[model samples]
Every structure is written in C-alpha cells, then in structure tokens.
Target chain A: MSDVRLSNGSPTLERTDPRLPEHPKPSACKSLFGPVDHEELKKDFNAHLRELEEAAAARWDFDFANDQPLANGRLQWELVEHSSVPDFYSRPPRENGVCSGNNNVDHNGNHHCDGMAQSEETSRADSQMECTEQSSGPRKRSACHDPSAQSKRSHTSPEEVSCPNLSHSAEHTPRKTRRLSALQCVQ
Target chain B: MEDQLLCCEVDSIRRAYQDVNLLNDRVLHTMLKAEENYLPSPNYFKCVQREIVPKMRKILATWMLEVCEEQKCEEEVFPLAMNYLDRFLSVEATRKTRLQLLGATCMFLASKMKETVPLTAEKLCIYTDNSVQPGELLQMELLVLNKLKWDLASVTPHDFIEHFLSKLKICPSTKQILRKHAQTFVALCATDVNFIASPPSMVAAGSVVAAVQGLYLKSQDVSLSSQNLTNFLSQVIRSDPDCLRSCQEQIESLLESSLRQAQQHGGPAESKRVDEEVDLSCTPTDVRDINI
Candidate 1:
C-alpha cells in the first residue's frame, strides 16, 4: 500500500533488498559471525566446500531426502550467495540504516526495472566470460547480487520500463522459450 | 525416518501415476460427444458443477475430507475443464450433447490424481443421483484424456496457496481464516471459466484477497476496493462484480455446510481440535504433501 519508489523510479516494488547477505568471509569471521575463530572458520568452510564438491560429483544420489538431514550444502551456498539466508544475517545493516527513516521503503517500493536491466546485462556479460573463468570453478561466478540472471528474462520492452534512451533492437529480445536448467548456475 | 525417505521416493513413484494427460484427453473427447448429443448450457462446463451435481458430495464423496473438495475444489475443477475446453475447441467443433457430463468426468479424474484415494465411478454416479450412467462417465473420461493429447501437468491454486502460506508466519487461526477466504476464491472461480487459465501465483493472491474479503464480510469494518483485486492481477483479468458476489455466496454456504457436518459427526473433541490454538512462529518449517 505504501507508494515507495525504486532506485530505477519504476512503479513496481522489489521483492527484497538487493544487498547481499553478510556471510562473514572466512578471514573476517570473528566480527560479523560472532566469536568464531578465523582459523577454525576457514577450516570449516574448506570442509564445507569439499563436501559440496563431493555432492556435486554425486548429484544423482541426492534426491529430496525430506526426512533425513540432507546436506543442503549447495542450496545453503546458493541461498547465501543469493542473499536468501534468513533476515538475521542481514538485519543488523537494516538496523543501522533505520535512523535514516528510509527503512519504510522495504515494504513498499516500485519494481526495480533499471536495476534488473543492469543486473541482467552484468549476468549476460558474466555468461559470455564464463568459459575463460573456468579455473575459479563455482566461486568466481558470483551471483550474490543478481539472482534473476538465470530467468530474469528481458521479455518486457524498454518502453515498458520507460527506458526511452535505449533502442528497441531485435537482438536484445529474450528468446521466448529459453531453457533454464539448474546446472546453468555454474555459469 | 524411513517414512521420510519413502515420501521422497514417493515423489518419483507418484510422477508415473500422474497420467492426467491421457485422462484429460479422454475426458475432453467424451465431453465433445456429450455436447453433440444434448443442448449446451449457458454456463458451459460449470453447469456440471451447479446443476448436474447439485451438491459437492455428489462430485466428490469421501475425498472432500482432505482438502480442495468443494470450495478449494471448484477452481481446481474449472481450470481442468478449461484445459479440456481449450483443447477440444482448438481441435474439434463445439456441440451440446453432454458437455456438463464431460466437465464432471474431468473433475472426477483430476480429483483422483489430486487426492490419494479417488472415489470410484459407481460412487460418483451414486452421488450424482444416478443421473449419469457408469458407461457414460467412463467414455467421457477417456475422451477428455484424448482431447488433451495426454499433456496434463497443469498447476492448481492449491499448489500456489500452499507455497505462499508456508512463507507467511501467521497464526494458525489466521491460517484457517485465510483458507476459508481461499474457499471463497474457489467458489468464485465457478462463476467464470477464464480464471481457470490463471497461473498459480495469481490464484494465490486472488485467494488471499478473497480471504480478506471474507474477513471483512464477517467483521463489518474492514473494506477492500476493486483496485486491490486489480493490483493482485496487475489488471490482467478485470473483476466481474456479479461473478465475485456469486462465488462469495457459494463459499459461505459451503463453509456453513462443513461446520454443520463437523458438528454432527466430529465429536466434541474433534470440534475442539478445530478450535485448537497453533503457534504463529515465523520460522520456516517443512509441511507435508504441499502439492494438490
């Protein structure tokens, strides 16, 4: 109901704040993650990464084991990188910004068409560069900021977003039935 | 623990059992044939729901116990009917013989796939007051499946409602209240066939609005504008005042009926359970069998 505006000034509200979740980098573990030793955190993270790699190799084996404590290691990292981890991880930053009185913007902002466009462009560029970035495996293709790269299609026109400056070119049009598989996350 | 693993395996096993495509195609063909044999009703397939089957129990007997039987069941049946209608219209010409029968058969097939224990054709016929013959039901079922060309991996509002409700950390009472509203939405769906084509998300939002409307109707203070419905659909489907009003009436009547039945059959303890309090913690927890 609140008529807050997106940074792009479009009239649709964003689902969540785009800022990434604060998963403390291993080296910076103590302050944000709370009292965790740096060495221990690094060791745990390395172990987690190893498990993820093992799981990746055995992806066929890990069906939805609803009752069991399945690692969800990939989903965990995907969520973290996507900033979809619970609010606890990101609540502090919002608290710090609460004094600005702009926090009310969270519930009621127009959709971010420009940011979506920018993010899409960045992701498409990343997709193009992905072949060369194979050495980094999964880490280098940071999806922390733009979750929609996989399916945030350019179905709408620039005119729809009121992007008058850009030319409406055929090449930029998103393919109608672009196949999106989970494995595309590697890109 | 083994049960959980079995449930996981059940998803894949259940996938194969889901022969809705075949079922839908067969049902549609039967419907077309039926229409060819009779005069078409103004309400199209919905006449099956309203006239052919006077009561919800007739269409869905014991299966109504679980969920999405009548109120939740209406929208479910509509889209299914639409899918059949769409396929039939695209391929074959329209007729008036047994269109309502066609719609009912699709609902019967869909209800079986949607619910675990589907009522038998005999039971369904018994419920419909012996108006439809067993052979006719079977014939329609096969025809609907054929018309659909066996492609029936359609979504339902129940699926979307489950997803959205899980995300919300509202109280159990609120959840029940929300579900009641959703029932209204399903009923409203009966008034119009177009809503059957809507995606699951739109249905969820519509159901939420319907629930809000139900609350408003009860409390007499809260009011919602047509703009809310417009915002929900993003102006996709214009709200039909008559249809919305009719759907609301059906939902209220259905709920009242359920309450009456529960009171008569569900002993004091069962009734108390209906009134029991559940926690409203906002934490995400797994709910079983979300698909409908």
Candidate 2:
C-alpha cells in the first residue's frame, strides 16, 4: 500500500508552515538579525579549526597537519587493500570535492597525483577559497612548511591540510580519507 | 554499461523508498535508545550560552522552517538542522549576532546529510539576505561538524512516526492522511522551544495521539480511541501514560496559540485556508476549536 511512503511528500510541511499556503510564499529573505562581521567570524573560525585539529592530534597522537604518524600515537597506521574495508571507508570522492585533497594521502605517502587526485581536484577549489580568506593570523605550518621537512614531507602540502578538511582525517570525513588515517605508519 | 544508467530512475531529488524491513519493534527500540544521545541540554541558555536566549531560538527556528518549505526540502531536514543547532549552542557560547549564521550553517549540514540534492551554499546565503557569506557558512559547517562530533545521523521525530504508524490497523488511505497530520504536529513541535530535550520517540508518540484526536478517525479496533491510543503509544515508547497525555496537551495548546498568532499576523483568508485543510473532522466547530 501507499502507506509506506510515510512523510515522503511536501504536503505536511505546507500544512505546518503557519503561512496560509499562499500569499506569495513569504519572502523570508531578509537577514534574521544583522550583518555578520566577516573579520571577527574569520578569526574565530580559524581559531576553532586550529583548536579542533590540535585536540584531535593530541587524542590520536598523529600529526594530522603533516599527514605523518606520531612515534607515540596509540593506534598504528597501516595500509589495507581498498577491498579490505567496507566501501564506506574507500569510496571515491563525491562531486562536492569534500575530501578530494586527501587522495594525496596514499600508501607510500608519495607526492604524485594519480588520475583520481586530478579528477577530484575540482572540488578542492572551494576549500582553497576557504583557506585564503579565513587564515587571519599567518597560516599554521609548524612542520609541513618548515623547509627542513619539505623534501621528506612532500607527500602533504600546507594548503591541502589548511583547507579545513584536515579535521576530516581526525574523524568522520569522506571514506577515502581513511587512507590518511590508514595504519600505514610505514615510515 | 552506459545504457544501464538510462534504465534507472532519475529525478531532481532522490529518495529511497521506505524499507518495510526496518519498521519492526527491534528498530523502534533501538531508535528509542538512540534519541537520548542526541538531545540538547534543556538549559543551555542559562548554563552555557551567554548571549543566546530561548526566544531567539524560536525566531531562528521559524526562519529555518520557512526556508525549508520554500525549497521543498525533505520533511526531516528542518528538525534535523534544529537538532544540530541546539547541540552546538549547548556547548559553545555564541554571540547573538552570529546566531543566524549558526542557524544557516546547521541547515547546510543537515540538508547535506539528508537530501539527495542538497541546498546550495549560495542559495542559503541569498536566503539570509547575504548577511553571511558562503565561505563563512562553510567554515561554520566544519566547526559544527567538529563540535557535534560528526554525528549527523540523528534520530528525529519523523523516524519514530513511521514505526508508530506501522503498528496501527487502519487502511492505507487513513494511515496516509493521519501520517500527514502527525508530521505537521511534529514540525510544529520542532518550532516551539518547550519541546527541546523531549525524546524524539515521546514527541512522536504525543504527536501521533494528537493527530488521532484531531482527525477523529474511526476503526473497529479498540485501541484507536484517543485515550487508548495515547496509552498504547506511551507504552510503545516506554514512557508514563500521564507524561504522554501532558505532552499531548502541550502540543494542543501550542497549536492553538500558533493559529491565533498566525491569524493576528496573517491575512484574513489565511485562517480560512487553514480551516479548509483540516477537512477530515465531522463538525467544523468541534475539530477547528483545537481543544478537546
């Protein structure tokens, strides 16, 4: 029976709108409060993202910013075949380019761009815009940007980690990022 | 291989058909247990937020609901977004000016979690009159994800409504109409601040009972009577009968007050249209009154 469609249509939402179903759909386009100060918002968001990355780094003991496993991290990073884990953890990036940059995180920590990385690069432009605009204080590049680690850490770029997607590696991000977290502490 | 794509259904928005496999007691019990983990702290304004007050939340919620309706978003997106908003506010002390930004970001995240074709950041910015930029929304979306620990699969009142309806013996048409009414009540509950921290299953039960009362549907079974159904649903959600009844009363009062308020602010024809929509009751005065 059609009963199984259960809350599938727009009828009920229309009923509950408190607007009379007509009258030009209420042009609720005006700002609810006032304009947000982009400067303060940018600063505050940068701090929050940095704090989250640090907290995750401490919790997991992996240098998420450098894409390198800490010597003392509680869990080991290993590389498993893509077929080993559920596809939920290894599916290719979706159209949104959410975790597209993390495809740089491969088995050998190599800096080379495979076909998948180039294809997914389209979505990372959103992240790039986010990075350049929000970094109020100079960007945090303690190890990744240090020229000393440049050759060895060529696998991860400062821009990729700064793109607000770093938190993806720490927790519930696109599954392909599981590669970055993949227990490959093969260093 | 390419022709197989043509054989599949394509639509602007995608939705999975309801799996009857999940409509069993096992799933219902699991949902009841999971709802508690996702509830917001009831007194976050007093204990956590220095600038945000409950009244402001009501305004934000009203705006979010309107946007969802305008976009024809899935029924679950608005409430799920509100859940994210409340959970974030519960732990963080946000400035009053940024509240709408937070609200918009919550919608952005929730729409992605629930919709096949989610709302765009640019459209959401336009909805806000461009007060908050898309970049800000994206940054806030990430902060919200971190604060909420990436748990977007929240159990909403919509989830519980399906399981409740499944146990009823009514025909598909009656079930369909009643589901619509219950869903309206659930959305109404989401907009009001009082229902904060109410377990989703209880809210769903109260809403189902209230819908049963408003429609005054008839069935041969003894349990469909308003009081019996309330008791039955309360048991199903594992709550006290008195608590469920009181919740039902709260929902009724909320509806009455919102309708009166809508009439005050809305046009004269507005109330009339609302009356025409609730057409199932036997008597206009009896059902339209909104009080038993």
Candidate 3:
C-alpha cells in the first residue's frame, strides 16, 4: 500500500517488502463483544456438538462421535485393506497435523474440537471393542489397523450429501488385513 | 546466487492468474444456480437472532473490513466471511457475547478458502486482544464448518463482477477501475443488512451499474447509463429491471449516506470530498475512506 503514495510528496525509494506487519491494525484489535466466558462457551459448544452427533447417529444409524457402525445403517461399513483403496484413506496425519495445521487435527485426520476429539478417542475405542465382539468372535487386535478412518454419519453428519469426496476420504483402511478378508468386519 | 534466485521466484504474489475460462456463460449460469443455496435468511434478524441485532452486525463487519484491508486479504474474503457469519447466525441464535469469536472464526475459514497464505490463528487471537484463545477459535472453526456443512464456496458478488464485466464492451483499463468501484460497493453492501439474501448476481449488477454511474462513464458507452445498464444486467441475471433499479438506488443512497457520514467526521479534508461528490455520488477510486 505504501509503494504508490506519490501524493504524500515523499521521494524516498521504497522497500519491496511484500509481507504485512505481524500484528494486525490496532484499531480493529480490541474485542467487540467484551469478555467471553470460556467456561460457559465451552459448555454451549459441547452441548451443540452432542446434539449434532445424536441427530447424525439417528439419521445414518452410525455413531460418529463413538465411531460405532450401526447395524441398521442403509449402507454398511466394512473394513477394507489399506492397499485396496487409495493411500489417502489410511495415511497417517501429517506431523503438522492437518494440511494447514492449527490444533483441529484429530485421530481420524479431520478437523474437530479438542473436546470432541477427547470424547471421540475414548468412545471410538469402546466402539471398536464393541464391533470386535460382534464382527469377529474373539479375534486378536492387529498392528496394521489404521486409525485415521472415522467418518461423520448422516442427518447431522459432518458429511453432506452434496460432498461425496469427503465421505469417500473418510473410509478407514483396515489394519487386520488377515481377518478383513475372512469377515466383512466393521472397524 | 542461482539458489537465491530460485527462492525469490517462489516468493512472488501467491495468487493464480485469473482464469479466463471462468468468465463464460456456463460458469455464470452455474453461479446463478448455485448462489441461492448460500444466502442467509433475509429476515434472520427477526426470526433467528434474539441477542444480536443489525447494528452489531455493522460494527463487526466494519472491524472485519479494517482487518482485511490492513492485512491485504483478497477482496472476496471479507464478503465471504460475512456470508459465513450470517449463515451461522441464521441457524443458531447466538449470544451477543460470542459474536466476536464467531466473526473471527468466519474470517479464519474465509481466509483459508481464498488466501494463499491464510491468516494464522495466533495472529487472529492477538487481534482479539486475548479475549478468545487460539484453541477457542479453532473449536469455533469446527462448529462453523459443521454448521455451514463445509459449503464454503458460496457464490459472492465478486464472482459475478467478472462475468458482468466480461459482457461489457469497455476497454480493459476502464473495466479494471469499474471493477474496483463495484467491488467496493459490494463490500459496502455486505456490511449493510438490507442487501442480505439478495442474489449475488443482482448485487453484482447493481454495484456495476452504480459504479458506472458514479464514474460518469455513460459518455463512453450507451450501455453504461443507469437505465440501460440496469436493463442489460437485469436481463443478464434474469431479474426484473425494476428490481435491479431499486437495488441500484439502494446502493447509491447507501453510498451517499456513507459519504455524508464521512463528511461530518472528516473535517476540512472531507469537505473537499463533499465538493467532489457534490451531486450525491461517492468518490469512485478512493477505496480507503469508503467506510460504511
């Protein structure tokens, strides 16, 4: 913005700095809504997310917050081998976490709140156990089970009917390749 | 020296060339079809919001515009962020206290959508003066993305500006200046609640017509006159010419009021602006002072 200020009457040569200052304009920096109640805001957010999750679970018959595949879901989820599908489905999240990286990256390599991730991590583990009991009589867990595979369900599913790419990318690669072939298991 | 040269080559402006392919009828038709899906409820202030009001929206929009201008974000970011804000508010009746956080989250998402080097969460938090944490912003971002159903590619008025300008027979430089003025009008409209839920194509047409009238470019082309341009663009967007005329008039009055406010606050310097804008038209090229 300073490069072409000819009307200002300054004749000094300008530096070619392309970047803006690290800090934003001070005029717009002050908070507009006064102090935020972090505790209260957190509560509201959790409740909203829970509602979204429950609606999604009912509509799609899958519990995304818990990563459990519902039996009555219209389209069943069967664990597939990592090599069977694209590497993007099973790839570990980048070290920076997500593509641009903030703190939104979760176990499934998608952006979610820390609270959601915490609850999702615990519940998903429990759901995996529940699925284990149902899918395979008593199969032992394997090392290759890729965990970056949790996808959103229907209704309130973060996955939209309009966006097939997102849902496609949500398919997790099965770690127990030996058992996946024997049984169309839910991971 | 060769290695340094290679590094410098990569550091140039990180935007892609304007895709001429995007300025075609097919794309314009697609945008016309797609734009309605992204509009906020026109009466969201009455139905959806209890704590937030129109006046508060204006304040937040002004601040967001300031930040975008200072940070040199792309023209689309501010309006896109505003779209996100309105969409979220349309669905969720939020408290007045969390409005800034919502505004910041919208900006974060919009910047990521449009900018090559998106605004960082840390810097955005700093702009909030620590009222909201980076983590909170990140969380809010998730909520917003989910609320929006990750439909971030909302057709903005800027999207229609190119197509409208393409159909115009003006010279390239003339089109460029007219585009700037129209974009400023679109940004101004984004701040005002009246233009909400109006089709982006209509807003773009209105802005183009209003800008052409402001620039006094009717002498260059018959199509540039207020009536002819309104008819032409209204047809292009397939709306009633009268509706387009009304939208243009609303924009003109908005510009006039904004200039009047500037004059009241700007003292001697603004008096000069008033003199230039004597016939109720805002300055065409000066974008910095056109705060709404």
Interface RMSD of each: 29.3, 8.8, 9.5
**2 versus 3: better lDDT goes to:** 3
Off by over 4 Å in 3: A1-21, A59-85, A97-163, A166-187, B1-10, B267-292
What's the TM-score of every candidate structure?
A: 0.33, 0.71, 0.76
lDDT string for model 3 (A27-96, tens) is 5577887899999988887776666566655554455544555756543444433465544434443354
Please list all clashing residue pairs in model 2, or write none if there are none.
A77-A183, A77-A184, A77-A185, A78-A183, A78-A184
Number of the candidate with higher DockQ, 1 or 3 = 3
All candidates: DockQ: 0.01, 0.18, 0.21
- Cα deviation of B35 in candidate 3 (Å)? 1.6
lDDT of each: 0.35, 0.65, 0.68
Candidate number achieving the greatest DockQ relative to the actual structure? 3
By lDDT, who's the top model here?
Answer: 3
Error of 1 at B235 (Å): 12
Residue pairs with colliding backbones in model 3 are A144-A175, A145-A175
- Where is model 2 more than 4 Å wrong at Cα? A1-26, A68-172, A175-183, B1-14, B218-222, B267-292
lDDT of 1 by residue, A1-187 (tens): 0112211111111112221223212221111111223354335434533443344234311221111112432321111122432222222222222112221111111112233443454345435433322222242212111111222323132222111111121112111001111111221
